[model samples]
Target chain A: MKNIVIGRYIPGNSFLYSLDPRTKILALLILMIGVFVIDHIMHMVYAIAIIFLVLLLGKISIKRIYLGLRPLLFLLIFTFTFQIIFNRHGELLFEETLYYSPVSIALAAAIGIFWFFTKRFIKFRLLYFLMTLLAIGTVLSLTLFPGTFATGRFAVYEEGLFMALFIMLRLIIIVTLSTMLTMTTKPTDLNLGLEQILAPLKILRINAEEIAMIISISLRYIPTLLDEANKIMLAQASRGVDFEEGKMKEKVVQIVSLLVPMFIISFKRSDDLANAMEARSFAPGRPRTRLHVLTWKRLDSCVLALSFLLLVTAILSRVLL
Target chain B: MAIKFERVSFQYTSMDNKGYLALADINLSINKTGEFITLIGETGSGKSTLAQHMNALLQPTEGRVHIFGITVDDKTKKQRKIKLNPIRKQVGLVFQFPEYQLFEETVEKDIMFGPKNFGVSTEEAAKRAEKMIEVVGLDASYLKRSPFNLSGGEKKRVSIAGILAMEPEILILDEPTSGLDPIGRNALLDVFYNIHTELDKTVIIITHDMNTVYEYAKRVMVMREGVLVYDGDPVALFSKSNIDRWNLDVPDILGLTRDLEAKFDYKFTEPPRSRKALFKALEGMLK
Candidate 1:
């Protein structure tokens, strides 16, 4: 729960903290779109450079941003593997014999058995098992299949490798930059910014203020709910819910044990909170004056314009280059 | 010793990445069995942090902790074979509002959950659960009911039964009766008393209730701002010249005894710890 970085605002006085919340959100959106539009490798590097600049200017600890990415490690690996395996472009890197004889098959089988046992007993079973499977695939390609050790038969494409790296870098940068925005910006300011940005949507007869309020309320509750969930988990852990020590099957039970109580607690809290809010005369959809109306400054405008200019440059590079 | 803390200190990094010291240079030890200990402190006095160390839930940031002679230090963390379940099994912690831990479909299954996790066979675990239900004063009929459907006090009892089913040698409760009504509080305390006296288990309670400290604790350990300020018998703790300096409350009966002695010529031989003992002294005075 402590590791959950989304919606968590760290108090700071960096340049990024001074920017209007709407500008930050808009800039991030543009920057994310810019990352996808860039086709060349050098352009990707330029995009990464821009992200690093934002990260540096934010003044948040890089270690904290890295910790926030920890939960996505498995997803990142999975997606990278999927892109590498399915992609078949650019030059072939190598080829080798994967299966040559019955004896070699038996050796591979022994290795597979070893891998299976290790996966079953290890701490990070999913990650270890996936990597082991990939290793076995590579070894099988090397020994079981009849081919030269270094030629183009069974191979890895350069484009596949580059695309995987590109995807992963894009994901990490986008997540980190967005997280940095929330880390530096307070929730009330973020809500006001969101309200200001979406106020134009009112012309379409859409109630944008309500949407921003909902988003802010939910964001405000995320850490509180996460805290409650952590308490429940610890309480259950003391009862011998070995979350870290269990087999895959036991993990399912452990998750249910955690989730059910959290569900009950969250629902109970929401009901109580609703009653408390109603008692205090808080009615939804009412015209409410903000305590801190967001005032846009020169820095916010400069940052927003620079982000837009960067987005245009990225699009031009993709098209004209 | 069941547990020992040697120059233990804990530093916590909250979500905001600010570090705060929760416990500082704490040294303490507990007997293996038949010791009823109460930990009294103001909030943030590290009572919970110290209890967590007893079962290796949280290792000390500095120095070492030994739970039943098994060292839980930084060096042992690298050795995966040194499992914490053994310590956790022996030192059962019933957290405050332990009822929140209940998640099994039935009360019986919830009680059986802890023993099952410790690798007890289903049949044996179920049997222990039945025995624990009786031990906690819950009826056999409650075994089939959903734990969530039970009343607040019943849920607390069932959750406590879950820990008792593990048959820990030392039972540690953190504010066991905080939100319960008077009858419920006494009922739960009676269950703990039975476990301590009849079963000969070591019971450690973290509480702010001075009355509970006076009536039940054989020894009281007091903490003030992450330091152990007092450790001795309850009588000695209450009678200290500067007991109020630590912001501790004396038990009502003990306080009343002192006030009565101040106003009258008759002298009470010694301050009694409980209401019944005070009343008995008064009866003797009338005779």
Candidate 2:
């Protein structure tokens, strides 16, 4: 089922996993912003180097990282084709009459960079330096390079293709980095980090702890919900309910029937969870002590400083440059 | 006054070209009152399918099912279908893992659902819920708590409470004690016994537990591969050598008593129901 991918975090321990979730989150955010800061090919080369260094430091296997890219192939191909067909200002590579322009080359280069950095982030073994290098390389390749294929009637332009590449790279980097943060960090750490990050809302009388509790519960239920859904699906199948063998509309109806039991079970589980929480004296406003306190280490401080610097650089490049 | 199936045959549709026959030419009748019937069968013995027919959950593919003089058939009139609801209301079915039927958030709500669905007033339903809560030997405080939060035994009790609130005349439980710990199973059996003795409701239990059948049931129905092989007194059914043929086991105490009777040339005036009963019978024979 598609839901199998939703919360499928493989349990492991490595340098990346040991880093505080807050540090990883902040670092990834910085790397994503920094990817857009580079405009030249040399800067992109540096970015690629940084990304690979990060991957090396993380100690993640290449095969594991490649698995994350499997689902994104179609999206990459689609973006590449769209850029090649539409961009119309670069030198024609294929035929002068067919508008086979330089933008196609740039688009493909951008996709390669996007795929590399994003795949590295999700795999969690890549070092920050390696990730940074990959990110910059991807951004520069899209921005400065000419299309590989162009024609006389419609030349594939470099600028528009770069823009498309930049947008896609940014999205992929952000999502993959976030997914990496989740994969490496324990759920408890993630919740605590969210609480700390959202602490500013306390000034407005918002309960950060309560919000954190909700977030933790939501994360905890993801795997549980998946398991319950699988069980219900199996149960329905045993009753001669063929979900896989059906037309599109019939499949939808079969899925609905499958979902009914899942929803019913979830509601019951939620009720149980609510009661269990209440029984444990867990009130919304009550202050609770943490077993694992969050403290900033030297590495965390470095990551924090780097994040702010990257953010500032990105904004400056956008406005001043 | 109760359900009677005459020469019923049922074939279950199978994926293979050669289909499976679930029930074959079975005839049985459930009495109106004071009947503790146990259906004993192996996994694919069509016992569950037969039980479903009692509540009109499944109509016999062949032959007639008459419940209180109303014949249950494929061509039964539409207006008569409405009558089946009342009959179904009377025949409360507790399926395997009956606890899964508990859908409401609160225990009270879960218990009241059946009564509410059957058009009972809120006040009456609440009253019934309280009575059932006591009947199931659960605390009143559990009523406000979630059914899912309770222990396994408590969840089973809540499920029973749900069905009991409907005030069914015939309560049918399918493997009510399966998967329960020994203590939990004993407590559940006590609940079933109380339902039979205190409420005077006709009880039909579907179980493979020969101990349960030997201890509580007045009548036993043995099914083997979709055939009703034995339908008679619990003692008579246990005494039959054909039990081995049906791949059924007699209760341990009953088997022991029978062995002693054959070997020592002695017989108890009445068959023992439990280990304690067997000891007492032995003491009586010695005296």
Candidate 3:
């Protein structure tokens, strides 16, 4: 819950924070398109640099985004492995001939068992996770040798490696860009910005402002709800639900125990909030005044122009080059 | 001692906060039986942190906390062999608005959940559930009903019953009576009072209510800015001349006793512990 950095607005004043949320959101959308167009490694290197620059502009530490990425570790590793195994391209990076006899398989099985027990004692989870993946990769490469377990070809291709790195980089860019937008923009300002972005819906009788308010309020409460979940988790921990010591079935039961309380409490909370808002005479589908209105300044326009330029160059490189 | 803190301190680490010192160095001891202690402090005073340390929910950052017989320190954390859940079963902690934790389908199942998790047989847990519901002042009929269908006060009782069903030797409640109406609060307090008297468990309650302090707390421990500044009899706490320094309101009974002493030109070596004690003192003055 603490590592959920997206939509977690840290209070700071800087170039990114000062940019209009509308501009930031639009720029991120454009940059995402740019990311999809750019297939070259050099272009990705540039993109990574630009991302760090944006991080600097936003006054967000690299550590914050790094922590945010931890939850995606499994997905990243899975995708990397999937791409490397399936996508055969330009040149072979490695070709190996190996055998998996009954004895060798038993040896690997022993190592697997060793890993299963030793994994708990290791505190550095990321390194351990990667080591486990390496073990899995080794297992996948092992094949039934013809006639008394002879050696077989195990291989990797150059473009397969490139593509795997590219896709993972793409994922990180997408996640980081969105995180940047959320980290800088205040929820209320994000709401107003969303209203402006969705203003075209007014022609179809849709209330963009109301929809935006709902979106931002829910986003604002994500962290609050997470904290509530943590508290409830601790309370249940006290009741002898050993989350760390549970079997998979018991873990599911414990998690269900957590979610039920979260659902009930969050519903009660929103009910109280709705009543309080009504008591304060808040009316939906009515003319509303803003405490602080969103503004698009000259700098915001410049930022948007730069994003548009980036998008054009990316498309040109993808199509023409 | 059931629990002992030796120069214990705690720092909270999160995404943004590298570490915030929530509890500073503190030393304290709690007995295993028949001790009713109230932990009182202003908000963010580390009272709750101290309470958490009892069951190893939050271990010390700087020093060791001895719980039952197990010691928690840097070494224990490193080894990670000794399970903390056994300690949890011994020291039950009920957080504020514990009603929010009521999740089981029926009230009986909810109460049984704790004991069953601690490895009690289902039948035995059910029997404990039957006993605990009544201990929290609920009728046995509540056992069959869905806990979600209960009223706020009833839900609160059900949650506390859930904790009690485990039959913890030490019970810690964090502002257990906060949201209840006065009548409901007193009734719930009486439930705990009876538990203290009958079961003889070491009960620690963290509260902002000074009146409960005056009434039920045999001893009061005051926390300020992550430090335990006072630990003694509640009567001695109220009698302190600079009581305002702790930002505590003089409990109503104490205020009335003070006024009675001023108006009647009476002084006793020992201050009255309760309204009934004040009444007896007043009778003695008249004589």
Best by TM-score: 3
Clash counts for all predictions: 10, 50, 0
Ranking by TM-score: 3, 1, 2
Which candidate number would show the highest DockQ if scored against the true structure? Answer: 3
Best by lDDT: 3
Instruction: Write model 3 residue lDDT over A73-150, tens digit each, in one string.
Output: 789989998888888889999876657566556656777787788988899976886787577457545664333365
lDDT of each: 0.83, 0.72, 0.86
Among all windows of 10 consecutive residues in model 3 chain A, the one with the lowest summed lDDT is A139-148
Give the alpha carbon lDDT tens digit for every residue of B22-119 in model 2: 88998988877788889998998998888877876666768878887778865553334435555667778776654346556788987886776577
Cα RMSD for candidates in order: 4.9, 15.3, 3.8
Tens digits of lDDT, candidate 1, B1-287? 88898998888877657878888888889998889999999999889888888888887888899899799975565677688777888899988775469888999999999999889999999999888898877889999999888877788788888998998889999888887788879888888988889989899999999999998889999988888888879888888878878888878888788888887767888777778888999998889
Query: What is the C-alpha lDDT profile of model 2 across A128-218, one tens digit per residue?
Result: 4346544543444442445535323434566556645655555455445555676677778878987888778989999898899888898
Model 3 C-alpha lDDT per residue in residues B234-277, reported as the tens digit of each score: 98888789988979889988888788889977886567767788
Find the 10 residues in a row with the least total lDDT in model 1 chain A. Answer: A144-153
Q: Which ranges in model 1 have alpha carbons more than 4 Å from their true place?
A: A1-11, A34-151, A154-180, A202-206, A312-321, B119-131
Classified by CAPRI criteria, candidate 2 counts as incorrect
Query: Which consecutive 10 residues in model 2 chain A have the weakest lDDT in total?
Result: A234-243
lDDT tens readout by residue for model 1, A1-321: 466666578787888888888889898888888887888777888787877777777777878787778778888888888877778899877545455455545566777799877775789766777777766666666543454334324456899888888888878877887788788888888888878888898789888888987887787788788877777877777777876788899999899988888888888788998899999898876888867767789998999899889889989998999
**lDDT at A133, model 2:** 46
